[model samples]
Target: MTEADFLQLPDLAARSLGGAVVYANDEFFASRENLISPGAPDFDPSEFGHKGKVYDGWETRRRREPGHDFAVVRLGVPGVVEGVVIDTAWFTGNYPPYASVDGVNLEGYPTYQELLDAAWEPVLDRVALKGDAANAFVVDDDRPWTHLRLNIFPDGGVARFRVHGHARPDPAFLTGTIDLAALENGGDVVACSNRFYSSPRNIIGLGRSRHMGEGWENARRRDGGNDYVVIRLAGQGCVDHVEIDTSYFVGNAPGSARLSGIPNGDAMSDEPSWVELVPRTALLPDCRHRFRVDSPTPVEFVRLDVYPDGGIARLRVNGRLI
Candidate 1:
């Protein structure tokens, strides 16, 4: 699949885009506390609310609805929606068999299986759509969905569901045709370098380019006499390790660079996983620099947080840019 097919604005990104509250359930609408609204444009519907809404005794079971049941959310803009991720922290209601999108009416049965069985029906526009049953979101093939309807079989209490997928121009009759043919005929597979982040900011590294804001500066150390060179990771990731290279510059024979954790919630855990620095050696008092993470865990992103007791220059990753 092309990058457009695999990475056209992930489901999480779509949910982040600010928009109007197209629709909500009348039975149990989420409190305005954390819900994103026109007035509070920056608010995230999933987190940080004044007062949380509560549902009664339904906590013991999940609700499942079967007929004419579903939640529909309409996006503000018409773009290639790639995927959807539903943060159902409150999905104590029911479990849905599946969800479907209805941009066009079915001439035969009301369900997807029936549409496949109707031989007399005209071919429908096959839009890209995907659903994350576990996460409670529906991702679609790149297509424009002005109105999205989620059909949930009546089960019980489902907190939230999201749809994912990007809106693309009509699937060309000739576009994926060539690629599809190549796959059938036998073609070499290709791999891509994925980008990620680490640390508290969850900084994302766009790529090895200047587009990612990068700069270096020298800072005086608390030790009083030495300074250190610092390079911040574009963004944090599940940083298992970091390899730094400082061979190009001369007159920089440093001892070591202390790895520090930036506290963002539990990131700076007092537990052993707090920060693992490789090459367990003292910071070079004065010299060049290079290092890596001793042992690390998955991180949203990380800053190349450094502490240089002495002045130095140049920093680069040692292994894959995980």
Candidate 2:
């Protein structure tokens, strides 16, 4: 996939996604926790800390010695990394000249010292970086990794770090009824009619959206049709029930919606033959709507159609793996 497409993948390192900055060799100038903060990095020229000019990124004291600085991050969704964005926004003067990343697979809970002693394999070799830029790199590895180590050459600040990749949730925990379209469950919104205002992926986020911006939203549709999104399930399953939440979407909720499922796990996504899961139903603004699926056929993909669309806070495809 292209860099922009890779960006659509889940940020496995986002703090909101349950990731953590477990350890850092040094964060003398700034705290290490800022690395995986949600949203874009911000800057206030007048902001300053005691030791020196305050930075919004992880920073270490200028190296008088001969080693680089690094931080270990535990991924929220362990999976194969497709790419990374080392955002050095607002760190023009003190940004790192070079950086690299390493990955390792671990299970259960391991202490910081144990992670430090674990075997590390390179995910992205040393790459050149630009100050105040979002340096992107595509990793070609296919193995699922649970943790990552980001290394900055010598010493400098890096505003943010994003590990973009598909989620590979532990299959052992995916048994019985579950949200088949949840990002943490290995499902993804692969296609959509429009995502002008916000991403459709948010419709299946970790939990209920706190506001309208946290949900899937489309621009006002002028012509005839409507807006919709196609979600690929974690696996082939029989969808038993569904939840459509428009909470916090007071004025922009879709007037109505339809749900359908595709049994073709390997067939093309655009196949015309789709089994009806739920017929067109009226939806209330800022309310949670639930429906029972009468279909019995197993499906790997499902499509949700919103009539003359607006916003959808969350979608739950609770079902059993077949």
Candidate 3:
């Protein structure tokens, strides 16, 4: 899948990141929360409730009325919708035959009633869906969205609903210095040298690492080279300080790390000229190391290099936007 595809982009409605299924027309057989579950759907043939077979997805009662069923989801972060996935795994006989998606942008916290009253624009028109399979649809809209409404023709079960897109941080909220390398702020790990065990993207995710699994980890390097990940900042900024955390990785943390930055639109060529923001410094396992940057250059990208390659729970580049 390409970067623009919803399957490749981050889920903006992930419950783990403060997203919520605000309202659903009906959920007789399954809960609406299941639609944004991070894990894959599971099945047990014998598992059945009074309503019907218990599925790991959103399942409404069989349509008896004239209208369709719908669910409203508040995005974890406002972003531009690029793609969507209406997964119907394990929902063969009871999956929705067709679906459509709509989005809306609103500021501040809004009530469910307010969301229902808002004017929602179409992200995906009505389209046919396959049973027991991931139904992916590419969206072309670039408008930032804060909420989404998924409409299912003639109510049925849907294993999961994933909305993927690029984060568009509000400039008003970015008044003070902040972590320019944060995922919620729009920073992304565009490229990495290695991701054998875990994804480098995790390092920039929201909040501190809960465990080693939530951080970036790579295989032990046998050769004499280092490991690195390049991150595109949410916007150009003058980096002030940096933090490298190795929490929960007591035994396999990098010994040292270095940080570099470059302006946006510059070619990231082999051995590209990188301005050293933080010199090679020693790191401790299960601890947080903070350093002040001496450079004052405005940069749109940052690269973190770990000596000899090991796990790094998180990397924070604190700065003020330029």
Candidate 4:
């Protein structure tokens, strides 16, 4: 019964009849927390969290500044509103060369001929997109909008924000959703099997040794971690690397491997935990699908140890999860 008594959102006509209300605004793209976007499904960005947003000021400074990041809501609830979907799966903000709102006075212009003398209409169809790769304008055309007004300029970043139409049970439509592996236990590793690629001329015995048995042998270059493969992004993020495929391996495709994780330090236990292994890329045995594991400080679990050749078949988490 909070989040402003469930976004009572401009009170969508005092609610009740049919329900719907989806508003989010913590700026920083709705405070991203596990939101991957690419062909979706099994879509793991690391899980996701933080279920609270809906700005217009004060909630301890609703994302503070730049007009408190913006988020005026008031979705429908009393039937017949028709359409309204605006999921930018993940979008950030930083526009000011031009902008417009008028009634609410968001007007700002400095170029584009003063933004066509201040007309501003296409806020990119109101905004929506999910990302891990393979992207496109997810939604913004489905229009009905009882009342919304994102508007942010001074660094914004969002992850997900669905609001399909058909109104009826306004419990504030429960805002964004992100579940991070049911909340922690990324330990008993389970998937990322049989991937391939290698050939300096078939580069000696390299076929997953009949099924990952013989010293787990599948070497390409060789560094140490006895090959590589690890994931823990059931939560936490800001990572930006990881995508791999060799088409099935054997030789001369080893140039990079070794990535560690967990580093926000001081959960304390004798304190020495500060893992971080780097080596983003370099295994282009003619490349195949995708690979990245660059970090900018924000982790939860990840380990890709394969000095010479570990093995892989599928692993992607461009954002969200941890």
Candidate 5:
């Protein structure tokens, strides 16, 4: 895959879904948690402390002796990494000159020592990096990874480490009814009409919206066309129920919404025919609406259409895998 292709992949390390930097060999200058901070890195020239300049990312002390510094991160979801973005934004001089990444697939919780001893496979070989820039790298491996180890040569600072990949859900976990549209469950927002205020992908994110910012919101549409988002399920399934939440969208919630489903095997074309699952129904602001699906046909994808454009907090598609 090309460097541009990395832009299309999902950031598997976004903090919104609980991705974390679990372990690090050293973080003397900056916190490791900053490596997975949501959104872009920020900088304030005068934002300095006693330790050093306050950076918006992981910064280790300069290596005077021995091996390089490293940090281990648990992915938000187990998936095949397609690329990575190691941003050194706002860390021009203190940024590491070179870096490498490795991956592992072990399940369950392992100790830091155990993780260090795990059989790690290289995802990105030692590569040069540019300071104060988003360093993008393509991962050729197709293996599903649960964790990642980032090694910085001779130690320094890194603004962010983004693992971009496609989710790979295990079929064995699809035993009972589950939120097939949940991001943690491997569902993906493949396409969307608008995401002016917030990302459409947030509608399928794990857990309820903690605040208005955690949900998806679109700009006010002056045109006639309504905003919509298409979601590819974790697997082909028969949708049993659907939940549409507009919490924290008191003044800008959609007037009404509709749901459609497409059966498996059909390519997601620009204008694929969709079978109606939920008819046009009115929605109230800051409320949750649940609907039972009457359609019996199993579907691989579902599209949610909000009437005349507005914001939606969350969308849950409860279904059983086919």
Candidate 6:
């Protein structure tokens, strides 16, 4: 894959999706919590604190001995990571010169001590890094991992850590009717016509978006056509219900929407490849539109089309796996 092709995959370590930095060896300069912020790191050259210049990232004190600095992260959606991104934005001088990553799998939440003693395997070996840049690495391990350990040479700051992969939720919790288009259920947005304001993948995120920025918003359309997003389902299933949430999108919600699916198909072709699940219907701003669908044909993919283009908070295709 290309250097950034992995970005198309879901980020299982997003704070918005429940990820957290469980532990850190030290954070005398900046808090470790900043490493997982959902938004990009912020900066203010004139912003200084009692310690030194304030930084929006995890910054440990310079080591005095022969050890290094490290932090542990609990992935929101336990999955086999395909790639990693160590973003050290705005940390030009204090960014880590090199870093490595390791991962571990466990049944339930392990105590801090137990996690420290687990047989963590290396996912990405030590690699050089440039300050104020997002370092990307594609790993080879395919085993599902629940946690990750980041090791920085000696000590320094890091803005963010992204684990890109698909979710591997426990099968027990996936029983009964479930959202076939949920990121936590292994579904992912594969393609989209526009993502100028926000990522189309956000529509598959859990719950209603807190604001317009949390959902997918395309730029104003000039091309006579509309906006659309294609999703690969968690598994082959017949859609039973659908939820289109436009919460917090007061003035920019889509005027109307249509849902279509491809039964017994593994790929997306032209419109002829899809069967109508929900016909184009009018939509209101900041409202939840729930529709009962009786699709009997098992589908592997689904598509949502918005007329002329606008914002969409969340899309749920509920069904049972066949």
Top candidate on lDDT is: 2
Off by over 4 Å in 2: 266-270
Model 1: lDDT equals: 0.32
Q: How much lDDT does candidate 5 score?
A: 0.89
Write candidate 4's Cα lDDT for 1-322 as tens digits: 2332222212222222111222334433232222212122232335453634432111122234445344443332222222222233322232211111111112221332332243433323333323222122222233333343434343333332222223333223222332111111122132222233321111111121232222122444433344544444444655555444443343444455555665552322354354663555565543444545455676655555554554443234344433
What is the model-wide C-alpha lDDT for candidate 2?
A: 0.91
TM-score (all chains, Cα) for each model: 0.32, 0.97, 0.95, 0.20, 0.96, 0.95
Candidate 6 lDDT tens digits, 1-322: 5557888787899887788999898999999889988778999999999999899999999788998999999999889888999999998878889999999988888988888999999999999989999999998778999999999997899999989887898777788999999988889888799999999999999777888898999999997999999898988988899999888888888899999898856455554467789999999999989999977888888989998798999999999988
Give, for candidate 4, the lowest lDDT window spanning 10 residues: 96-105
**CA lDDT, candidate 2, residue 229:** 93
Instruction: Write the residue-wise lDDT of candidate 1 on 1-322 in tens digits.
Output: 3434543332322233322223333333343112222111222335642334343211112334434343334443334444443333444323333334443222222343443332321112222222222342233354454444433334233334333343321233223112110111111112111112111111111112121112122333455353322223322333333434333222333345544333232433355234444433554422334454544443322223343422222233332223
lDDT of 5 by residue, 1-322 (tens): 8889777768887777668899999999899999999888889998889898898899999888988999999888888999999999998889999999999998777888899999999999999999999999999989998899999997999999999998776667767999998888888888899999888888998889988888999999998899999899888888899999999999999999999988853536767667788999999999999999988888889989999888899999999987
Supply every candidate's count of residue pairs whose N, Cα or C atoms clash at under 3 angstroms.
Answer: 76, 0, 0, 55, 0, 0
* Model 1 TM-score (2 dp): 0.32
**CA RMSD per model (angstroms):** 16.9, 1.3, 1.7, 20.9, 1.4, 1.6
Model 2 TM-score, all chains together: 0.97
Off by over 4 Å in 1: 1-8, 12-15, 29-67, 86-93, 103-133, 136-140, 167-322
Task: Write the number of the candidate with greater lDDT, choosing between 1 and 6.
Answer: 6
Candidate 2 structure quality by residue, lDDT tens digits, 205-307: 8877888999999999999899999999999999999999989888889999999888987435455568899899999999999999988899998899999
